[model samples]
Structure formats: structure tokens, C-alpha cells
Target: MVNLLLENGDLVVIEQSDFQQLLDVLAERTYQVVGPTIRDSAIIYDEMTSYTKLPIGWTDVQGKGTYRLKRREDDALFGYTVGPHSWKKYLHPPVSYLWRTNTTADGFQVTTAIEEPPKLAFIGVRACELQAIAAQDQVFLQGRFVDADYKARRENIFVVAVNCVQAGGTCFCASLKTGPKATSGFDLALTEVLTGTNHYFLVEIGSSAGADVMQAVTHQPASPAQIEAAEALVEATTQQMGRTLEPLDLKELLYNSYEHPQWDELGERCLGCGSCTMVCPTCFCTTTHDTIDVTGETTAHSKKWDSCFTMTFSYIHGGNVRTPLRSRYRQWLMHKFATWLDQFGRSGCVGCGRCITWCPAYIDITEEIRAIQESTNKQEEKIGGKL
Candidate 1:
């Protein structure tokens, strides 16, 4: 809690010194501030106490089989891109206890689980990652079998999204129409604008809670030049992206490429390491397990995150369904771009490009899609010749 004072005026144009007030305001409301911090040589989401914890003036270079943090020329709080961690780490945790039971001498009764969710305030969230959280909401909260833990956590979220000022080497959110700008599903959205001798955020109010938080900080009305500068920076980021995924007709294109040889090609490169699923914000598969004490006096049931890349993920009584690497890869790709539409009415991938950057084998999904499309075109050409 850094000491900073604001005068009696409209709190709209906040300065860097006043940023700490925003966290203090959330803390006063009993909302724990969870945000990005540089650890393990990567920017990760963790419990943040002050503005000093933010990775200021740091951006990252991300590509297939590559990632490195680099210092920026100017001081900007939200200049960096996303890392291996996503908001789902808090909203939908990797592990949680379902319920526990203790045996009684006379009789036994099942003890159900009831855990209250935390009041969370997420800082420095990106637009594509926000879209990823919305997609996860459809999986956990909107479905018939609502995940109680996820629902509890989702209900109490307060998001502070940041628009991208610089695109990473593997970024493609523009192609997926998901990012470079914060559009919706955020409480407060900010675009960091840094001009010569001027650095400020063009803040946009998205929710009542956001407005309440704004009251705690000191701000002034933004000039038209500032707003235009913000827009220009976002457009620059969009144009500087390192990859692209064609969104038009993507569903049908993937759906019809079931037998594409690219699946076999990528299967050879894919390590089945589950890195993509672990980094992906939208991958929400889980498996539950029960643990009993040695004396059998108590039992505990818990659920944790799982991945389709595992052979046992599709296991049945007989054996694994997707045993082969090719089949497993096909299932993952097709489900993300094809069948996910039929199930969720939207593409599962938000084009965050974590799968492309963090992969040990450099297995790029965009390249796979391109190969499939080329193969499809060749087959169509052959058919035309036959006709």
C-alpha cells in the first residue's frame, strides 16, 4: 500500500503514481489482487501487492520453440505479452478438493463439498485471454453440469484488462478477431499509450465496479490526440503480428480434413508433452481421483486438470481410444477448429499462440492448417481433371 493522495475531481485520467491507489481500493473492498509478475524467467500470474511487482518496461519475444524476455526502451506497466499461465489458473484451478468422508462406528454418511469462492481482482489481463476466459465460462458455468468450484469463482471475478501495445513474435489474435484491443467482458479496459515525454492509459469504463474503482484514483479527461494514439498503437500491433490463422471457413476446412496426411506429419513432431493444454486457456479437461488413508478412517476425493494429449485421457475399460500419436493429434486439432463449433457454437482457439510458442518440438498449429488446406486444394484439382 503506497501512500498517494487524489484531489476532489473527476477520476478519469490516472497517472503512474496513482496506480497504487487502484490496488489499495480493491484491497479495501477485500478483493485479493492477482496479477502478472516476472518469475522463473517468465511472466506469470501471482498474488500482487504493489505496482513494483508488475513487470514494467519488459516485453517478450515468442515463437515456435522460443521465448525470451527483453527490456523495453520506455517504462510501461502493461507492455509485456502473456506467458505460460492464464487466468484459468485461478478461475478454474488445476487441483481442487471435491469432498472428504470420515467413517463412523455406528454408520457412515457422505460429506458433500461446500467451499466459498474468493473475491478476486485480476490485473493486466489481455483481450485474447479475456476471450479465453469467456470461452471457459461456456464450458464450466453455462453447461448443464455446472462445475461448482468454477461457477463459484466465476461469479466473483473483477477484471482489469490491458490492450496490447506491442505484438509478440507468435501473436495472431487479430486473425482470430480476438485481440490487440480490449472489446468486452472486462470491468475496466486500458490501452497503454507512450509518446515522446508522455505515457498514459486511455481507460474505458466497462462495468459499475470499474467506475467505483476509478473514483479512488485521480484522473483527467483524455485528449482526442491521446485516444487516436491509442488506436494507432493497437493497429500497429495488429499489423506486426508474427503469425496468421485464417478464420474464414475454418470450421468446415478442419472438419473435412479428417484424413489429411499432415496429421501424421505433425504426430511425428508432437511430443505428447501436454505443454499446449497446460498453457492453453480454453482447454478444460479434468479427471477426478479418490485418496484414502492407510487405516481407511477417512477418504478424500479431488479433481485436477487433464489433457487430451495423454494416451490415458481417452481410456476406456478395454484400452485407450486414441492410442496412436496421429489419432491423438488429429483429435486435438479437429476438436479445436471443427467439432468445438458444433458443441460450443464458437472456435475453441482464441489465437493466443501459446501452443506455437511454448512447444518443445515447435509444432505450429497454423502450419498444420495451411498444409491441410493445400492438400485439400490438390485433391479438388485432381477431381476437376477427372470431371
Candidate 2:
């Protein structure tokens, strides 16, 4: 693999063919290749063979609370923003069997479940996703109670981050200070460069493992002009986001606006179907249950994704604290924008906009924040008038 400095001064370039070959080599080494593909007219992550399965000439139109697919002028793989799915599907599965129990002469015997970590090569991961992974790392890996299952899978995974060349209308990653360019927590990073004369990807190695993969591929040294083009592409995407969040002190804003009227407005339209939490990359709440087969002799316990919007989520001994729809809505928003930072040292929402797009009622978080800001301004005006 040829390595040359690009104009960005921080990036390196590898030929597109070389990048494709590297995936083949990783698969040969027992990595399950995961990347973006066109599924049901939207870009979703799935197992891929080579680069042919990637979403080509596909881009998404995202708004405050809408998403649509549109054709692109050229066949550029990884051309779209995130869809309903994220890398969490593979890293942390929807449902997993923790263990099993069997009836025995002595009563019952429990067998602990053993999981073998699958070596994974995640292709086309975006900057915000990398940040989400890092945030989850703090929760599952570094906490007092470490999740063995999550730890095993995380250790065997390899990340390949892609600098976003296009932004969705619902995206506020720039306002959240998360994306448009990958900063860390990846093995390799790629920037897709498409120009009038040349179409290639500028690659950069983030670790020794990525460097080894680069060595096996055939590549030519990247020129400075190519690097500049890639940087410009990322910059343009950052500027193109359709939605923006005000630069408010999130912690103070949420803490003080506990009775904001926006929550009541959202509660009326919200179905509380939990679709937003299901599609969100960072919502990790879960519930457990035990089920018996028709025979009644065999039983299994399972855990599945859960959300704060549900009535049972806030259940106490005899009643639920957040019984009202407005309270549930406020809990969700406050947890995401305020308490999560205190608990996890990061915002729970990654600004991916999946919640906005997937919500049937089209509730936009950015717009909600702006409404709160407007309300706060009016409240301050009334206090001044009283004085």
C-alpha cells in the first residue's frame, strides 16, 4: 500500500480498490463484514460481500421530523446519512438468552450461557456513531458492574469510520459538537472524494491494526489536492444540516424548565409507542421476563429493549411515578438533554435524527428545544414587567 500525505495535513490516502481489497483480507481473517446497504429503500447496516452491496447513488432527505430517499447523480457508496439502524444492533443485540434452567431431581439446575465473540469489521461507521460507541463503553465496560457479553463483543470488533460528506435535514450533530469529521475511536477513517476528474477515497490509519491492513492493499501516494477536496466535502456537509439547536446551557435549561409547556404539547401528539427509543442508538433501557413453552415443562428468561415512555418503566411498589403522558415525555427529554450528561458525562442523544424521522407524529428534538427557549424568553419578559 502506498502512503502519501494529503492536503488536510492530518489525513492519508489509499486507493478505492485497495480499500475494497482490505475488506476481503479482513473477512479471510474471520471478521464478519458489516456495512451500509440499501434495504427497503433506506440505507441500513447488514453483512456485505465486497463493495457491490453498498448503497450506491442513494441519498436521504431528512427534515425536522421527516425522511425520504432520493437518487443521486452518481453511484457513490456510503453516500447517505444514517437510517433507522445503527451499529448497536450488532454490538448489543436486541435479545439474547442469558442462561437456561432445567428441572432436575434436586429441583432445578441453571446453566450459564457462554458467548463467543465474533470478529467484526464495521465499515462506513460515522463520527457520531463512534462517539455513541465510546459513550456506551463508559456504561457497559467501565462501570461498577461490567457486562461480560458486551465486553466480549466490543473487544473483538474493528471500526472503520467514514467522514460524513452529506448531512441530513434532521441532523444537528454540528450543534451537538459531535460529527462531520471523525476525531478518534476508529481503526481506520475514510473520506470519499468525488471530483470532475477523479473519484477515490482518502484513507487514514488510526491504529497499528489499520496500518497492517493498509500494507496489504495496492495504492498510490495521495497528492495534496486530493486531501483538500476531501476536507472541503466534510466542511460542506457540516454547513448543510437543515436543523440547528440553540447554544443553550443544556443542564441549566432542562433543570429550570421542568414545567415547560412544550412537554404538554408533545404529549398530546405522541402515541407513546416507544418507536423513538427503539430507533435511538443510545437508549439502553431494557426489561426482562420469563416465558414457558406450551408444554409448561420448559421455561426461558429473556431481556428486550425498553423505554421510559412506557407506563411500566416508572412503576414503583403500587403505582408509577410518571403516570401522566406529559411527565413521561418530560422524563425522556430531560434524561436525554440533561440528566444523561450528569450520569454518563455525555449527552445521550447523538444527534443522528433517527428518532425524529422514525416517530410517527414527527416530533423533532431541535424544534422542541427552540420552543423551550422561546418560552423561557417570554417568562423572563413577564418577570421584567412585574419589576
Candidate 3:
């Protein structure tokens, strides 16, 4: 354990073994430690009682509509990119029961559901994910009508963020300015450094709670060389980006692109399967359902995840608002990149690229945005020609 208080922040150089002890410390604090684990051949976050539960030597290869897990020659707990699941599933559950009701003759009794937000320690959270969580905080907490359940769940969770030492083929956090290194919104952050035969983690404390946790873990001040190694690791990951999303005026671009022919093209390619929204780390669309019992005495009112890709999402009394595939596709893309700004004061996307990786039809948001830009440029050229 080597700990140092640098000018930038508090830094600690801990061996691989001590990293496991950090998990134990969190467990002792009664935090249900959830982190990356190899399950069904993919790195998924779940309850991890021991460091062994982590995908120690596993990484992932991700591309448009493609994902595969591969083994690294060395042990690295969080070598992979964002998986099919996100922290959203835990805080804002995929399926949640809001309340139930029981009818008596012509009257009804309503029962409110109780929420038990767990004290959770989220390990191996990437920088892009941290940004996504921040974006969602605006949705669930800062919104006019706060989601009580999500707020409770979010308030109790402790985040241990991980700096990306490697980026997936579909990742574009560099362009989003959200990754390679975690700047804030974490209790602690870690950068994995594999130095020849030795592998270690550079731990950084971000909050007072994190400083408290450090008391339980074995750690020592990081040397200058180790600090340099950590910086280099982040730098290398930044340089190895597999994709890039240009930070254009996406709001204006998408707003003007409503009539672009590309929407029709995307409609043809899109399967309306809702894979993008399902895998997105920040998408928060949901629908409520009420089920009546066979006896007509009891009913269950539930809330579940919804997607703009589905026709049912825009359905109203008269008809489905977005009947055409192009309209549905346009609604999703426009809302994600355009109207979200008006609603949330920020774009909905955090540029994790999970939507691209998990989409059954290789639909890439970056590619689509670029297409919109090209179309805009072409339209400008035509107008200039007439002038």
C-alpha cells in the first residue's frame, strides 16, 4: 500500500491483492457490491461477494451490432467496455410495480408499493457511465416530478468509477469528453496499469466517504513513476478510440433534418426492435400497466421500460402518432439528439455506444449523425447554387 497526496488529488498505489481488499471493505460497510462478472459469455454487472466474481482477465470486442468477450493475458477486472446492462437497471428497474388495488362492489382500495433502496457499492463503473448517471440524475432527481423510487435507489448507491484503459470498437467517449479518465461524480476512481510483469491500480479519492473507505484498505502513496504510468494508461486508451462522434450542433442539425431522405433510409434499415433504447445507458422512457385479476377483485399497476422505436410508444386514442418507420426512427433520433436538450438542458446521449453494439441491425448513431450533416451540407449547396 503506497498513498500520496499529490497537488492534483489524493493518489494511492495498491497491488492487485489490495484491490480485492477494497471490495471486502465495501462489503463490511454493508454495501451490496455490484460489478462486472463473466456471465453467459458477456461481462455483466451483478452482486459480487468476492473479487473472484469479477471478470479478472476478460475484455470485450465491440462494433456495430457485434460484441464478443476475449481473454486478456493479464488480470484486469474492468478491461471491457460498457456491457448490455447499465447501472440504470438497478436504480430505475426494467419492471417496477407502482401500486395495487382491490375492488369492493363499486369501490376500490389502493395500496402503495414500498421501496427498499439497497445500500450498493458499484465497482468498475466507466467514465462514460458516470456521465450517463449524471445525465439521468437530471431526469429522475432534477425533473419537475421526481421519480421517488429512482431517487431512493440513487441516493444509497456508492460509485467506484474506473478509468478506461482500453476502448471498445464501438466506443466514442473521447468525442463526448466523458471518458479515458473520470473527472468527478465518483467516490473513488481507479486506473489499471500493467507494468511488464507487475500489474497495479492507481486509486484516486474523490469524496470524504472514499477517504473513509481508504482507512480500511491497505495502500501507500503512489510514486512519480507510478503516477506517470497511470496517466500514460489513460492516454493510450484515448488514442486507441474505435469511433468518434463529432460534437456538432446536433440539436440544430437533427431539428433541420426532419425531412432529410436519410430518415427514410434509416427506416428501411431499422428493424424497430428497440434494441438501441434497451441497451442505452441513459434512455429513460417507460410505460405503466394495470392488470386485473381473473376474479376482478385485485389489480396490479406496474411500470416498465419503453422505447420510442415501438409504434405503441406513440399510440393515442385516434391512431399511432408515429405510424411510419421513418417517423418512428426520426422521433427516436431527434429526441435523443435534439429535443432532449430542451427537456433536460443537456443532450440525452452520453456516447457510450451500447446502442450501436447491441442493435440487431448495426445502426450506428455516429454514422447517422454524420449522414445528417452531409445532407445538411448538400441542401446548403443546392440553395447556394440557386443563389
lDDT of 1 at 180: 84
Model 2: runs farther than 4 Å from truth? Answer: 3-10, 385-387
Models 1 onward score TM values of 0.95, 0.94, 0.95
Report every candidate's CA lDDT: 0.85, 0.82, 0.86
Could you give the candidate ranking by TM-score, starting with the highest?
A: 3, 1, 2
Candidate ranking under lDDT, highest first, comes to 3, 1, 2
Over 4 Å off, model 3? 1-8, 104-106, 381-387
User: Looking at candidate 2, what is the lDDT of residue 141?
Assistant: 88
Q: List model 2 lDDT by residue over 1-387, tens digit each.
A: 444422322356665555678688788778899999888877889988778888778899876456788999987777888998988887777886677677777787777664787889999999989888888888888878998888889999888899999888788789888897998988888899876656688887787777666656665666889888888999999998867886558778889988777888988988888888888888888888777777665667777778999999989999999988888888888888999889987788888888888988878888888889888888899999999
Q: How many clashes (backbone N, Cα, C below 3 Å) per candidate?
A: 2, 0, 8
Cα lDDT over the full model 3? 0.86
Report each candidate's C-alpha RMSD, comma-separated, in the order given: 3.3, 2.4, 2.1
lDDT for each residue of candidate 1 in 1-387, tens digit (9 for 90 to 100): 223332222124566767888889889989999999999889999998798899988888898989999998988898878899999999888988899888998865678664798899999999999999989999888888888888889889889889998888888899999998888898888888777877777777788778777766666676777778888999899998889988788788887777777888888889998899899989999999989999988888888899899999999999999998989888888888998889999999988999999999998898888888878888899999999
lDDT agreement of model 1 with the native = 0.85
Question: Distance (Å) between predicted and true CA of 291, model 2?
Answer: 2.8
Which ten contiguous residues of candidate 1 have the minimum total lDDT?
1-10
